[model samples]
Structures are given as structure tokens and as C-alpha cells.
Target: MDVEILSRIQFAFTIAFHYIYPPLSIGLGVGLVIMEGMFLKTKEPVYEKMTRFFVKIFALIFGIGVATGIVMEFEFGTNWAVYSRYVGDVFGSALAAEGIFAFALESGFLGILLFGWNKVSPKVHFLSTIMVTLGSMFSAIWIVVANSWQQTPAGYKIVGEGMEARAEITDFWAMVFNPSSVERIMHVWIGAFLAGAFLIMSIAAWYLYKNKYQDFSKKAFGIGLVIALIAAYAQLVTGHSSAEVVEQYQPAKLAAMEGHWDSSGAADMYLFGYIDKKKEETVGLKIPGGLSFLTHQDFNAPVTGLKAFKPEDRPGSLNITFQSYHIMIAIGMLLISLTSYAAWLWRRNKLFEKKWLMLVFVWAVFLPQIANQAGWFAAETGRQPWVVYNLLRTSDALSQSVQKEQVMFSLILFSLVYLVLFMLFIYLLNKKITHGPWHTDSDKHSSRHSDMATELSKPSSQS
Candidate 1:
């Protein structure tokens, strides 16, 4: 493989791995806020116990997210120096805002959130939880704004030429609110919510399945189900809004997403299919004119296709883009179905009665993660060859001094390090989950242990 391919893979791998935690962190932050709020409103000891338990897990996720994220910043300078220089001013402003507005607020309140349980008043700690959650969400805003700007460049002027060429912000707020930013931000936020909610539900369902912590499990599962059901439906709206933005600004990507090949016509939306790139055909089950209606609210409205763009300008991996997009949609629909049914059962007071449903929920923790990854794969891959949309070709963005061998070696090292991190994370997470939420009731103890409250509530257990 050439330098470009290797560099792309390395960055992708690192970022993809790093991507796992932020959504969980963000989602969990929201959950924390709600849990803590409930404790305040109802003065329920159970909610406090739940909040405390997940606060520990949230800290673990935040630590890992921060650690993994630093690598990508360094990679920008090491592997994509030209790209960094090109977007530095814009990204700088966004990141600086992130540091000031998001990170500062989040970290400032984090210490209080983690250790202030005994030291501070309940109201003060609850305020900190809200602040921390807001901080996580604010962090996402700047990051998504920066990324969305790449997809739809706005309010920037090109300064210098050739190797010295870079984009400078002419209007900062304009750049921040660029065409695609809001929709993309909402999309990402909702996805994170689902990730966090599903995770909670997954664990809660597991506890219920094992006939442990029945009260806590039911309450936690109910909270997760509410968030999941709401977010799942909201995703549909944001997804459509995002598609509309893509159609207007990045028709080529929209075409690639749906495997549309005709130069101009109302496009069909595929439910599932195989794209035969060689033959320029997508053999699939589809709704005829479905995409056209979605994008234009007109069944016969013409949508641009891949043929409208130069072949070299088109996304290189049509199948990957198409498949990843479809996978995201498929998982989303599945989640909506599951959550809706779960909500119905809860409403009927039969949610926990179904052992089969509990079994499914125990494993459903992975669905949001998979969907999040697939959504990212589609967005990034569909915009391929352009790291900064029309402004900078990905090929031209590499650090010319770096060799493929160096990239490959670094990639290998990163993989090994991340593998160990993942293993350690899983081990610690499993240990925490096994410990279960601290409980006063002796009957709720697992077969493997007694006095879970005494064991899990120790100061040392905050890790």
C-alpha cells in the first residue's frame, strides 16, 4: 500500500477506536443528569445508588476517551501535516472554544461530580452533574461543527497558494453554523444518547435476567427505555435532515449512499442490496422513488446521481459506503422497533415479565455502538478523496516526509496498545457490573458474592 492508503487506515483505525467512548460518555452524561435529578425530586436512595454506581463507570469512559483522543491531534501533525495546516485556523478556533467552553466546564465540575458525593450538599452535587453533562454535550458541538465544516465549507477564504495554501475564517460564527453543522450535531448527539441508554438498558436487563437487583434493574431499564425510544425516533428526523443537506451540498455522496447511477432521475431507496459496481447496478429490494420523495417531497423529483460527477471524483468504495449506510439504517429501524415494543410492555407493566425480551436487551448494548460506527463509516467514506470537501484532496494532505513503513509500524503499535486498553476496559467494566449497584437488601446479592453494597461502596471502588 502507498503512503496515502496506509496513513488513511492508521488514522481511521485510531479514530474509530477513539470514537467508541465519546458517545458513551455523552450519552451516559445525560443519563447521569436524569438519574441525579430523579434522586433530588424523589429523594429515592435507589436513584442515588444508581447515580453513584454509573458515575464511576462514566469516569472510566471519560478517562479513556480523553487518552485516546489525544492521539488523533498528534496524528494531524504527524500523518496529515498539510491537511492540518490547511484547516488549522478554522479547527484552532473550534478547538479553542472546545477547551474554553466545553472542556473547562466539564472538567471543572467533574471533580465535584466524582468525589463531592460526601463533601458537598446534594443540590450542589446535582448541579455539578448537570454541568458535567452539559459540558460533554458542548464538547460535541465544537467537534461536530469542525467536522461538519469540512463537509460543507463556509465563511472561509483561501489564503496563500500551492503548498502554503490554507483556509482562514472570515466569519467565525458563520463557519460554526455552516450548512451541515446543526443537523450533523443533532444526529451525533442523538446517536450518543442511544449508545448511553442502550448500555444502561443492557446492563439492567442482564441483572433482571439473573434475578438480581430486581428493583434497581427495573427502574434503570425503564429510564433507558424512555431515552432509547425517544432518541431512536429523533434519529429518523435527523437522518432525513442530514440527507437533505447532503443532497444539496454533496449530491455525489448522496448518490453513492443509495447506489444511484443514472445521471439524473428520481432515485429509488434500497432496503437491502448488493451493488455490482462493475455493472453499475444495485440489485436490491427498494422503494421506487422513495429517495426522491424523502429529499424533495415529490415522488418524481429528479436527484443527481454518481454519473453526474467525474468518475475520479466519485467515492472510491461504492460498496463500502452503500453497505455501511444501509447497515446504519437497518440497525436504527431495529432499535426503534425494539424500543417501541419495550415501551409498550413497560406501559402494560409487563416489560420485565418477558424473559425473552430481557435476554435480547442484555445483548442489545452493542446495537447503538454498531450503528454509530456504521453512520461514521458512511459519512467519512462517502466523502472520500476529499478530507476537506472540495478544498483539499486527501491525497494532497499527507505529510510528504512520512513513509508507508513508518505509518504501518505506527499502526501496528497503536493496534497493540488499543487492544490492551480494550481488554483492560472490558475486565474493569465486567468487574464493576459484577459488583452490581450497591444495595442494602441482602436477598439481592449474587450467587458469587454477599453484601454487594459493602463491597462496591468502598472508596477504592470509585475507579
Candidate 2:
């Protein structure tokens, strides 16, 4: 492969490594807020123990996320210098805002959340939990805003010409409210919530199956189940909205997603496929007019195809885009099924007896992580050939100073480094989990009774 290919591989590898933690951090942040809030409201020692146990995991993931993400910023300048200049104004504002508002806020309170359990009041610690969760969400918002602008650029005007051209924001608010930003941000948040919820469920399921921490497992399972269902359903809604936006603004990318080839008439959604790009045919089972119905609420509405665009402008690698998107959708559907089945069983109050379901949850923790990566791949590569959508080709965006060999060397080096980091993360996470929470059943009961007594001793006022 050439320098461009090497650069793409390097960036992809680093980003894939970096991505492993942010969603977990965001998801675990939500979990911390919920568990801590419950502890404060009910004064239950179980909730308090759960919050403390998860905060450690959150801190670990957040630390790793920060370390990995910093390299991407340097890559923008070193590997994609032209792109850096082209969109510097836009990305700078978004990323700077993220650092100032999101990262700073999260890091500031994270200290208190992780270390202030005994140092500060429970109310203060609970407030830290809320702030951390919001900060994680806000981190997601600005990042999505920047990326969404690339997918569907808005409120910006190109200045200069040719090699000197750059996009400058004409309307700051319009730039922030880019066409795809809100939908993408919501989808990411929902996915993060699902990831976090499944992680908790997996651990709880493991505990139940092993006959360890029975009370802890049940409480965690209940909360995780509710959150997973809410997020899973919300994912369906947000995913649909995102597709509609894609149909309107990036029809070629939409075409690649479904392997839709006709320039007019209805689009059929493929359930699965082997797309032969030269023949422009997809060999798969497809719902007739399914895409049209989904996008336009009409079975026969016209949907644009790749043929509508000039060959040069068409997104490269329809197969990669098609497969990645369909796989993401398949995983999403599976998540809904898995969560719904468990929810139905719980409604019958027979969930605990189902050892099979618990076993499934123990392995299903990887589902959302897989889906999130696949979705990310589809979103980025689907808009192929272009770094800034219609504005700049990825080939033109590469650093003139960098060579193929340099990128290749770094790629190999970083891959090995990441492998070590991944192993260490798993080992540490497993160790903490094996140790279990700090509280026993007796300690929990004593705390609960003490809380009740304190509540009873408080003076009642007649209003």
C-alpha cells in the first residue's frame, strides 16, 4: 500500500484502540450517577457499595480514553496536515470547547467521585456523579458536532481557492446545529448507555451464575435491565432518524448502506448481501421497497443511487460500507431481542431461575461494543474518498512531508504498544471484579437499619 493507505490504516488502528474506552466511560458515568443517586435517596448500603465499585472502573476507562485520544490530535497535524488546515477553525472551536467544558468538568469532579467517598458528604459525592455523567455527555456532544459538520457541512463558506481554500464559519450557531449533529449525538449517547448497562448486566449475570454476591447481582441486574431497555429502544428511534438525514444529504452513502443501485424508484433494504460493485448487484435477501418506506414513509418513493453522482464523486468500496452498516443494524436488532426477552421473563418473575439467560448476558457484554465500532466504521468510511465530504478528497488531505515508510513503522510500533495496554486493562479490570465490593450482607443490613432509625428520629412538622 501507499502512504495514503498506510496513513488511513494507522489512524484507523489508533482510533479503534482509543474508541474502546470512551463509550464505556460515558456509559459507566451514567451508571455511577444512577447508583449514587439511589444511595442518597434511599440510603441503601448496597447502592453505595455498587457506586464505589463502579467508580474505579470508570476512572480506569476515563484515564485510558484520555491517553489514547491525545494521539489523534497530533495525527491530524502530522498525518493529515492539509485536512488540519482546511478544517482547523471548525475543529479547533469544537475541540477547545470540549477541553474547556467537558473534559475539564469531568476531570475536576472525577477526583471527588473516585476519592471523596469518605472525605465529602454523600450529597456532595452524588453531585460529583451527576457532573461527571453530564461531562461525559457533553464530551460526546462537541465531538459529534465536529464530525457531523464533516458529514454534512453547514454555515461555512470556503475562502481562497484551490490549495489555499479553507472553510470559515459564517454562522456559529448554524455550525453547531449542523444537519446531522443532534441525531448522531443522540445515537452515540444511547449506544454508550446500552454499552454501560450491558457491562453491568454481564458482571451481575456472572455473579449470579457463580453464586457470588446474590443480593448485589439482583439489584444491579434490575437497574441494568431497565436502563438497557430504555436505551435500546431509543437507539432504534435515533438510528432511523439518522438514516433519514443520510438519505436527504448523502444519498450515495445511503445507497451504499443498502446496496441500492437504481437512480430512481424505490430502494429495497437488504437483510444481508455480497455486493458485486462492477455489476452493481447485491446478492442477498431484501425487503422490496423497504428502504423507501423507511426513509420517506412511502413504499415507492424515489431514492437516489450512486449512479446519480459522477463516478469520481461516488463513495469508494460499496461493499465495506454496505456490510459495516448492515452488521451494525443486525447487532442493534439483536440487542433489542436479547434485552426484551430478559425483560419479559422478569415480568413473569421467572428471570432469576433462567440460568441460560444469565449465561447469555455474561457473554453479551461485547454486543454494544461491537455495534458501536461497526457504526463508527460505517459513518466514516461510508462517506469515502472525501475527508470533508464534498470539499476535500482524502488523498489530497495527507501530509506532504510524511512518507509511507514512516507511517508503516509507526503503525507497527503502536499496534504492539496497544496490545500491551489492552492486556493490562483486562487484567486490572478482572482483578477488581474478582475482589468484589467492600460490603458484606451484615454491613449492608446494619447501614439500612441505621438509616431508618435516623429517619425515624428526625422531628415531624405539621403543615
Candidate 3:
């Protein structure tokens, strides 16, 4: 394989693996704040227990997210040195802001959040949770801002120095509010919320199934179900808006996403399809005028197609984009249905007792993760060929000095290490779920020591 292909694969693998954690962390961080805030408000011990139990999981995810994210930074310099230099002026400031305003602030208070539960007052602890949540959100903001600029290429002046083209920031605020940033950030944050919400719902459902900590599990389910439903719904709207923006600014990508070969006034949205790239057509079920209405709010508005662009300017593999976009939308719709059903069950007071439904929830735990991954693939792969759209091709950005053998070796090493880490994460997470939070119940203690120590056992237990 070519070194560039190997390098791209390595980076994609590492990024996709690493991405699994951050959104969860970000989403769970907000859930933590809500849980803790309720504990402070209601003076409920069960809520406090829920907060303590999940805080440990949140910290574990945060640690891994930080660790894995560092590799991407190094890869930018090592595998794509020329690309890094090209966008350094724009990306550097965004990254610097992330460090100064997001990572540092989040890290500073994270220790206090983890260990200061008993050491600090409830008000102070709640404040810490809020700060951590805000910090995580801010971190995402800068990242989206940087990536959005790459997608839209705004607030920058292109400087041609000999053989290289570099971007210099002309307006910092404009860079922060790039055309794609707001919609992208909203979609990202909502996806995070869905990830965190479904995780909580799955775990809570498991606890209810086991008939353990009934009150705590019920409250957790209620919170998770409600938030998950809202976020899933909001995602539909935000995703639609984002698509409209893509259609307007990145017509080639939109064309690939819909597998549109020729321009039409009323485009059809494919529900499912197999694209024949050679034939430049898709064979599938489609909704007529759906694409036109989605992109332009008018069925008769002309939609651009891949054929309108020069072959060199086309974004990426049409089949990949088409499939990824459809899969993402399908999963998103499934989530909406599932979460809405969960909410209805909760409202009827029949949620906890439904064994069959609980089983479905257990299997559906990975839905948000799948949707998140598919959405990312649609966004990134849909905007391919050019790393910075028309401004820079990926091939031109790769490091000229790096050999194929070196990248291949690193790729294999990364895959092995990440696989081990993923297995370890699953093992630890399951162990935590099975063990559950620490309980102070006397019955549990007495059951443990009944045979050996009669004096240490108690007859009555506190609830």
C-alpha cells in the first residue's frame, strides 16, 4: 500500500477509537452536573449515591479521552507536517484557546470534583461539577471552531509563498463563528448528550432488572429517558440545518451524500441504496422532492449535482458518502423512536417491570455510539480529496519525508494498543456495573459476616 494511504488509515483508526470517549465524557459531565445539582436541591441521599457512582466512571473516561487525544496532535506534525504548517496560523489560535480556556480549567477542578466530595460543602461541590461541565463544552467549542474553518475556510487570507499556500487569520471572532461552527457544534453537543443519556438509561434499566437500588434506578431512568428524548429530537433539527448549510457551501459533498449525478429541480432523497460509481447512479428506494425541500425549502429549487463540478474537484467516494449519510440518518431516526418509546413507558409507570423492553434497551446501548461514528464518517469522508476542500488536497499535505514502512509499522502498533485498551475499558466498565456503588445497609453487612461473627451482625437494617 502507498505510505499516504497507510498514514491516513492509521490516523482514522486512532481518531475513531479515541473519539469514542470524549463525547461520552462531555455528555456525562453535563449529566453529572444535573445529578449533583438535584442532590443539592432535594437533599436526597439516593441522588448523591448516583452522582458518586457515575463520577468514577466519568473520571475514567476523561482520563482515556485526554490520553488518546494527545496522539492526534503529534500525528498532525509527524504524518502531515505540511498540512499542519498550512493551517497552523488558523488552528494554532483555536488550539491555544482550547488549552487556555477549556482543558486547563477542566483539569484544574477535576481532582476537586473526584476526591473533594466529603471534603467540601455541597454548594462548592455542585459548583465544581458545573465548572467541569462548562469546561468540557468549551473544549468542544474550540475543536469544532478549528475543524469548521477547515470545512468552510473563513476569516483567513490565503498567502502563497513559493510552492505552499498558507492561511493567516484576518479576524479572530469571524474564525470562531465560521459558517459551519454553530450548526456543527450543536450537532456534536447533542450527540454527546444522547451518548451519555443512553448509557445512563441502559445501566439504570439493568439495575431495575436486577431489582437492586430500586429508587435510585427509577430516578436515574427518569432523568436519562427525558434528556435522551429531548436531545434525540433536537439532533434531528440541528442535523437538517447542518445539511442545508452543506448543500449551500459544499455542493459537491451534498451531491455525493445524495448520490446525485445530474442537476435537478426536485431532488430525490434515498432511503436505502447501492451506488454504482461506474454508472454514476443509485438503485434504491427514495422519496421524491425530499432532497429539494430539505436543501432549499422548495421542491422546484434546482439542486446541484456531482456532474456540475470538475472531476478533480469532487469531494470523495460517492458510495461511501451515500451509505454513511443514509446510515447516520437511519440510526438517528431509530434513536428518536426508541427513546420516545422509553419515555412513554416511563410516563405510564410500566417501564421498570418490562423485562422484554429492558432486554431491548440493553442491546440498544450501542446505538448512540454507532450513530455518532456514522455521522462523523459522513461529515469527514463526505468532504474528502481536499483536506481543506478546494484549497488543499490530502495527498499534497502528507509529509514528504516519511516512508511508507514507518507509517505501516506505527499503524500496526496503534491498532494493537488500541484494541487492548478497548478490551480493558469494557472489562472495567462491566466490573463496575456488576459491583455497583458502596452501600451502607446493615442487612448487606450482616449477610456477609453471619456465620463467623454473631456480635458484629444486626437484625434490623436501615433503608
Per-model C-alpha RMSD: 5.3, 3.3, 4.8
Which candidate should be chosen as best, given TM-score against the real structure?
Answer: 2
Candidate 2 per-residue lDDT over residues 1-463, each given as its tens digit: 9999899989989998898898998887888788878776766667777887888788888888888898899999989999999999899999999999998998899898877765677778788889999999999999999999999999999998887788998988799999999999999999999999999999899989988988878888989999999999899999999998998888888988888889678888899988887887788999999988998899998789877887777778778788989889999999999999999999998898899889999999999999999898889888888989888999999999998989999899899989998998999889878888763233454444335535643544221
The 10-residue segment with the lowest total lDDT in model 2: 440-449
Backbone steric clashes in candidate 3, count = 0
Pairwise lDDT winner, candidates 1 and 3: 1
**Best-fitting candidate, measured by lDDT?**
1
Which model is ahead, 2 or 3, in terms of lDDT? Answer: 2
- Output the lDDT of residue 453, model 1: 33
Model 2's TM-score against the true structure: 0.95
User: What is the C-alpha lDDT profile of model 3 across 151-189, one tens digit per residue?
Assistant: 898888889873487889999999899889999999999
Task: Look at candidate 2 and give me any clashing residue pairs.
Answer: none
Candidate 1 per-residue lDDT, tens place, 403-435, comes to: 999999999999999999999899988988998
- The runs of at least 3 residues in candidate 3 whose Cα sits more than 4 Å from the true structure, single-residue gaps closed, are 439-463
Give the TM-score ranking, best first: 2, 1, 3
